[model samples]
Target: MTQTQNTTHGGPDALGVPAWDFSSNANACGPCPTALAAVQQADASLYPDPTYAALREAIAAFHAVDAGRIVLAGSASEFIGRVSAWTAREGGRRAWWPAQAYGDYAQAAQAWRLERTDDPAQADLAWLCEPASPLGGAEQQAHQVVGSALQVVLDRAYEPLRLRGVCSLDPVAQNHVWQLWTPNKALGLTGVRGAYAIAPEHALTEARALEQLAPSWPLGAHAVAMLDAWLSSAAQDWLTHSLPTLREWKRELCAMLEDLGWTVTPSDANFFCATPPHRLNAMALRSHGVKLRDATSLGLPGQFRLSAQAPEAQVALRRALIAQKERVA
Candidate 1:
């Protein structure tokens, strides 16, 4: 079966794109004006620099890291596969990740034939996602694995959108694990697929190995523009300003869900998991152009994840839920 068939995700288009989508955890206040303008101005007619020298430099400067430490990928999913393959090539035989996480981690490990292990110390490679997917909470045992000899990659996709709490790792701890970043989600431009990883400090050999595995020109002009724009003062400012709004929206959304008899879990990011008092006909809701991510694939059965969206979207969701209930009645 194809990958789509094998794995389910929040932002599926098979049911037609939802009008009030609460499935994807993208910034509700974005695409940031500056970032969107940059993407629009991208000169798609010409091929981006084959080596992505300038792109790498822009990303490196944003993260305050050496240019050599920046490894580009088409997207987070692409990086997961490439990195898993790299681990396999380097004689990695076992992988460990949170019981709840982005599905690509497991899919990549399985594709590379790495045995799955629950214990982080026993695994050749470990994956950690702070403000993790579905749950939007801190990674468990994150502090214990820091500075370990075992290869670890910390997915920081949600770090930019974090509304509360700090990352578990300090600067010294952060230097030991690969920091994977995808700016599109935070930019509210998830369609613009591009991502990068900051290699562990002093790991020039591992950095070169990842680069060699990457296909030529992994990032196209638009992606390059998005990543570059992501570093702009205006873009950063916009993101910083949007957090308060998202925090308010998240508060109201959670309260509304709780009123509807759903148990809302606390989260650090702009999304949270909830279990309704009654089983929901998610497909029925989707037919009405309202979509919520089923958390089952993320190891939380009978619960759904909803991204913090505009007030109007929340109203639409409440109406849709009530309508679905009426239809079932």
Candidate 2:
């Protein structure tokens, strides 16, 4: 797909929202009550601290890192753009990312005129999203690219929602790369649009550069509130409690799709990609208020990425798929 078309994200748009959305990978058991309450109670009347000192401190404490190493972002997309810009500013000529991964990485690279490289070592910058989107599988190349001269940024957006498997990188290895986290996904509050990157330990220079590139007041009050709640023990406990429910739902959904002859790919996160035995008319399903992310944009043609959702939503999806099949028949 062309860059313009490939960059399309799965969320409410001109077609309106889906009744059973399995497009975006937000936690099925969320918006967590604690985080939701915090967002609702956010004082939007006043601007957040420009320095984001308190917010940074809170996030830093949660990760047990120095506040100075925390680089704030308006959102994951914003950070992608800012980092791409930083790469460009530093005379980076090329960028590398997974062949099938988030489209924004490519979009940002395109905007900055950075040539795409398939080999990590050949690129000035590289992007890695663990339990990556579309397939939701562990990144096979993660360990290989480490210790290279490549400026690697690990997108840990799905880490909180990971249902199984251990991360490929140990603490020492993780400390060598930029670790980006978007709490909104874990909190099931994507609308809040706040993210932060824990700069590699001892990489204060690069961290300072990223901070300088970001816009002032990168996070608004609501985003700050959601993120603040994200670091709380109550919120963590809520997320912990939701995982078992998600695991069970995932198992049921996978079984249902497999029984229907869909090729469900194994995944460690809350989402997975599958290709049906027959071609599926996605728009037809969307008409019935059921939506699945067309993975063609994420470089997986003839497949769709589905997020684990409540059983009722799964039932709605199954009904819609059957209806579509009937219509085609």
Candidate 3:
């Protein structure tokens, strides 16, 4: 009896071409039985109340800020969407967009008819990213934040720098800025849709009133369970301890790609950007079963944003990309 194996990962890997999808900002969370059970047990309960209460404490404590500063939401995207609406209602001023930032920032500004301006002091809002999501390098990063003119809406998706660092919550910008954080991106909870906003405590005054006029809110009992489990010292230790292995894997990714002749932007964050040799564009990379964000969208000099996935996955990607190099030559 040829028993069929239950394959859990549903991707092009099933095909001969290895799949390297580095489009997301999330760790490949371990689906431990205990954590999975927390989600399963929530099958018959309402989550918003319990989840929010627990997460409120957990997240705020993590950031070392007051819980009131947080606006737990479906995702960082939601926080941005609502905040843009608030900016509009308060009279959308000229929008400050990074020379290169998350695509949604442009969409958010347009939805509210915000004018674009690179000058920060004269700007009404600044929508930006940190570790500069699409592209990353020490010098490029320093240039991005070297001397800001106005309020900073730091997209600290990579802030904790892998669990051990002091979960820096944009301290410099905390005085008069709005930042986005998503546990989904940070804690391998991508599938959970857990995100929170860290604004100055006073921004809460303006935000709380606005939140009332906002739509209904709820935290899935399941999501809460995951958050609860994640808050425990045990879970924290697990994540905090995994940094070395994670860092090693990331370094391996950069070294391997470099050895294969790819120009990877230096990044300590979970991902990095790469400029393929002139002969190859993003589609060519995708053809090898890796779906990278096209750098062309950022109007940058590259055409790919690669990530470091599981070690096995990285090995597969390295081989595929190397094969592509040979094919082009």
Candidate 4:
């Protein structure tokens, strides 16, 4: 049975594509030309190396870590589930994550029947993300937990797309937690579905165990190509260049929402949550060819999470909201 049938996400929905989609935090300026070319040229007919030897080495070099620390996954969500399952298998009873975080963290814990706890000190496993999802803010108590013996997974999916602010964790602290990297969002290639985790410096044994849980060839050829391209100078440069445009668009988005009487939440990343002057009817907006991510599933009800978009799309969203209000009036 599929657990995701009820899972809430912000991209294209059952109604098809939205004219203006702000449901996801993907880089609005991409699909990166370099990464796209690599995916297009991927050798789909041939199987990727069962061990992914060269790919793992490249990723290790990119992060300047030992190859043994690189644990490949089909995607970020897949890794979340894998690690949660690993914790459960190893006799872990409790898991902790930020009050508001990507739903998969909770979903995986639930699937593995791990009890949820509010206190990280009491938890056998913990999850943290920064420039966090929905809020696009820092993870509370990150520094303390990162260095502790508690098994921690630090989702760095949005770090590359950070428009403002610096990571609170220093390099030394970062080496103590499992650093999960999903470059698809930064490259604006979310559809590619590739991700990896740099295990803590002393977690080689844990990393090997997690690898055992994975199926052979967990990442397909397209995913391999996408990740391989993700490490290239061209793709990295393109991603770096996209951030300023995203930052400008984020400013415009926040300004536009504020002008419309929405209460915008401050964030350091490319997205933020805003509460409309009145209750938001997401379906009504969807009918108007606009799709916004309702933060209800992300534990922030009555608010919407919007990723930065180009000016034209922003204008379209502005128009739609105004039109909706006028029709109601």
Candidate 5:
């Protein structure tokens, strides 16, 4: 939505395949070889010690925070779950708000015995999908939550805009415990299953309690290295270039969907949510080999999520949807 055109990543340039909206995180700019090399050089003998220490420092430095405030996690979900669990036990109630966004938040509330309410005033914690998970509400609602520069677990899974200005937190301070960045949707890093959490001291302390209770959640040697490489200078530069390309691709996909006369949400990030124009059922789409998600598992409905990361996947989705329109017509 920010950039106007998508000239760089058209057909085969960004992906070897011919699709644009795939589930794999191919839309991301990070996770290239520039980062993979770091994985190889990682001192495996020291195991979690060196990797965790190095990761803590890198994350803290990247987010501009004191090293002591940083907490590490193998995955962002682990960090969030720990926090939610702690809140339930300590706060004696679920920090749940009656809002419709990411389902994980509600699940956390339910797990911790939090109640959902329509009134924002009654809410103590808000689990926002920062740039949002393709539903497109986080931007407007964020200011209210981060009243005086609020804290966030920014999931820059597909940062359309460089986090500098867009993030609600002290972008320079790295105050929030940002969740994991994987290649599944963008760089094909899903198989590797590596993720990181960047958090302030208190949040880290709370989340770390879960780790002490369950040490198995720590990241493996290579996965942590993969994240480290992306944080490296050369990799960052690559991201600078790759992000816009993804932006362009996303824009193009939305336009094409609109042109087809199907009611599609205008998406700024890599994906959009839509029910077929005729109010088509998503279950049928899955049966046709299109295989769209119902958003219910992730907490959305009549809407499907697409990965704008891979050009081939998007193109494939476009074709599939276009064909579906004809069949329904």
Candidate 6:
């Protein structure tokens, strides 16, 4: 293992929850009622089936994949670390990920001492994320990267919340790489930590290795309930219906940033990156109970990732921005 520092994240911080926060990529319209109710009603008194037989079957049916191909994880981050460790343990020496991606990818690589390489062809493992984080743009080189790497994992954490554009990878290409899905963010239930990965076709050996590496009952009852709810027609319908509202909110967010003379980057997801007209006083904003995700940690300095929020939250953010500007002036 390698020495590492704590990674920065966007949710509630040491100051506690911000009054208006645009730091995390969670669905602003979420904690979907259906999913929430399922979690609330889950039987916490009992441990879920050790094998998660029924839950795995349900998720597999939803994706139209074999039950044996489903790999349950405590969360997406947990899977990242496990897979990276698997790569290193299998005599894999190098890894690669998107230019801008979740920090955990790199952190996992470091922990496994996998040499970081910019060229996917030279790597034993490669990671991809569509509507890539911090930038929220399509991964243009996905095909090349997926084709080159010996083992690949595509993070689809934001797919359900995608407001525009389609997945860059077609079904055929997708089958060549692992598809990691974290429905908690989309269900608006980030507190419910659960995720699943679809093993690439004929990759049973590797899939079993991952399953063997996992501790028993990786998902708790609440997580199992939440994920089950996510596959329901009611929850799926709710998600589809929420998109238009999110699109409108995103429009308002972009317009507000543009009006403030901030450069907003176009994105297909609910979140996008923006650069303030002046230097951002993040601490001052936090003091005012407002927070934005600083993109510096994600290799995109001078930009902040802002998720589309409701009108009231947007208004609060605008006022905070104006106040911070005046304070700096």
Off by over 4 Å in 2: 1-8
lDDT-based ranking: 6, 4, 1, 2, 3, 5
Reference-based TM-score of each model: 0.96, 0.96, 0.80, 0.97, 0.75, 0.97
Which tens-of-lDDT digit does each residue in 67-101 have in candidate 3? 77777666667767677777777776777766766
Better of 3 and 6 by lDDT: 6
Pairs with steric clashes in candidate 1 = none
Encode model 4's per-residue lDDT on 177-214: one tens digit a residue: 99999999998888889899999999999999999999
Better of 1 and 5 by TM-score: 1
lDDT of each: 0.89, 0.89, 0.61, 0.90, 0.53, 0.90
lDDT of 1 by residue, 205-289 (tens): 8998999999998999999999999989999999999999999999999999899889999999999999998988787777777
Please provide, for model 5 over 1-329, each residue's C-alpha lDDT reduced to its tens digit, 9 standing for 90 to 100: 11111111222222243323243335454456666566667776765663377777887687576665555555555656666665566563525332445555677778777676544445555555545664542456554544522233446555533322355545433344334444323443544556555554456565455446445537777777776766677766776677777677667666766776656765555556665556544334433434443454445545555545546655666667777777877
The reply for model 1, stretches above 4 Å from the true place, is: 1-7, 147-149
lDDT of 6 at 229: 96
Candidate 6, 6-123: lDDT as tens digits: 1157887666888887888898898799999999999999999999999999999999998888999999999999999999999999999888899999999999999999999999
Candidate 4 off by > 4 Å: 1-7, 147-149
In terms of lDDT, which candidate is stronger, 1 or 5?
Answer: 1
C-alpha lDDT (0 to 100) for residue 224 of candidate 2 = 92
Q: How much lDDT does candidate 3 score?
A: 0.61
User: Residue 250: error of model 2 in Å?
Assistant: 0.7
> lDDT value for candidate 2?
0.89
